[model samples]
Target: MGQVITFGEVLMRISPRGKKKFIQSNVVEFFFGGTELNVGVSIANFGGNVKHIGVVSEDFIGDTAISYINKFGVDTSSIGRSKRPLGVYFFEVGAVMRPSTISYNRSHSSFSEIKPDMVNWDEALIDGEWLHWTGITPALSQGSFDVLKEGLQKAREKGLTVSADPTYRRGLWQYGKDPKEALSELLHYSTIFIGGINEINEILGTEYSYSNEDFIRASKQLMQAFPSIEKVFDKIRTSLNSSWHKIRARMWNGKKFHETKDLDITHIVDRVGTGDAFAAGLIYGLRRFDDCKAMEFGSAACALKHTYEGDVNLTTVSEVTTILEGDISGRLNR
Candidate 1:
């Protein structure tokens, strides 16, 4: 029985080891990443029983994925496999003022063609306290959306809390349907809903400023639009450069809206998976303590992501705690 169950694709991320780009470099490194998978992996790293549910190709890449995710302590027994090839992504980690670029080669991959009846949700979420997913799945295909809705409903009936990140990526959804339709439908069933304010505005057909008031209005509107959401967490960021960032998060938990202070992050090795890190932290907070302290852990975890170089963060619990304690002094640990 898993305590945390998540479903999402996992891709092989190929990029240069440091700041060099593809054309300007040789000797690129390999790591695996998928937002849903990242959340499950992070929970496992923090000493939780985490299960990753997704389909992978039966080829060599799929074989490698089992090994890759196993190292992070996620239970891999619940995954589905097919005789196809896994998806691949190319990344160029930005430096200075340049934005990072991602080129996905995932068309016709395992997940895009996944069937809804592939996994036994009853067994997968038997003792699950939480089930999480993202809007990205709906963008993949209608089949995947049905699979997610089924899994989440089963979790709901079993009295498990459902959480989701409306990580609306522009490139993922195909087949001529707007993301708003699918996302709105899914959000109606979620206990907690999270998203980027900018992403939501684009879908909502509105303009918003970068101030707290703007996000405050956005959360209020989204919460009213979908009443199943008891809480909304928005991770607000202000980028200074490719290597540094200022971030804070706000939460609207039914009763009131709360905001955390801005955290200055330096030496950011990667940013792709940071939002998932925030969600993991927020979920942990929801399960462990009151909303304020939970927000603290969630914010701190995002800071720790800036220090790591892969899709799954490689930092220790103590390290995250130190950051949570406001020690950005960067002292070495034993």
Candidate 2:
């Protein structure tokens, strides 16, 4: 398998310790994560070859971020540095019934300063077999959108599989570009769609409900509109509250629909990056397993991510496999 190429911003996540509110905490914790970076790190942790391309502040903070990514064995050679500060978000981890809150301070960050010419996509994607991108990149700025589009185009030319996770954020599209237009354009280059009904409805400007029947209908319509999308994989989450959730995945791969059983997560250590984990697992599994097994792998990985605290999923491949093999007993290793 060739390297998995991930392109997006590198963000520093700052959060109050545990379930305490910002006003109640005197101490905080920080982690290095971004949607694409989290997926890259999780893939690397699973012993996959992965490379990340992004810009960070040309300061100690950026240095530390690079080091943190390097610690996960992710190739960061394509990453650049800028005078602007690294993007940061303050998160307050919430418990049952209460929801989590996040505030972004990334408007003028180093990643938003990215330009098309800043990266040599041909060189960055030379050894890449899969390229993953999210809606967050293009939502930041015109420069970021142009840069991502350039990379996607190059990946297409190189015959690499492009995975699109249209993680649309209504508040992030303040750059005047139509969200539907931008995402629809990128979808033309993507082969796999790693999103659900909400994303499809957002991009296609259709109102689709959350039913499985609607999902199949929406997915069929999506493929009809964008024939390049060969397969659609969705991770469905049922949140009983902030602490307890159930995850299951379903896929429409042109000819058939496959679904997985619900994986219950009774105590979520953290909710962030669980979707990215699903994407990573699906990417990894597709290389080795069939479509149904891949969806099962993704759903299991997503459930396991809630057991770890941070924006990145650190669970190993064996651990995820253990869960997939029906071993959710939380047994001791010793």
Candidate 2: residue 169 lDDT (0-100): 95
What is candidate 1's lDDT per residue for 1-334, written digit by digit as tens?
3488889887888998787889988899988888898887887787778889998889888989988889888888888888767878999988878889889988788887777779889888877889998987878877788889889888888988889888877778876777887777777778887776776585566687757677778777777777777777888888889888998988777677788889998778788788888888787777878998888788888878877888986655677788877788987668
Best by TM-score: 2
lDDT of each: 0.82, 0.95
Task: Tell me the spans in candidate 2 whose CA falls farther than 4 Å from its real position.
Answer: none
Error of 1 at 268 (Å): 1.5
Q: What is the lDDT of residue 274 in candidate 1?
A: 89
Provide the global lDDT of candidate 1 against the true structure: 0.82
RMSD of each: 1.7, 0.7
Top model number, lDDT = 2
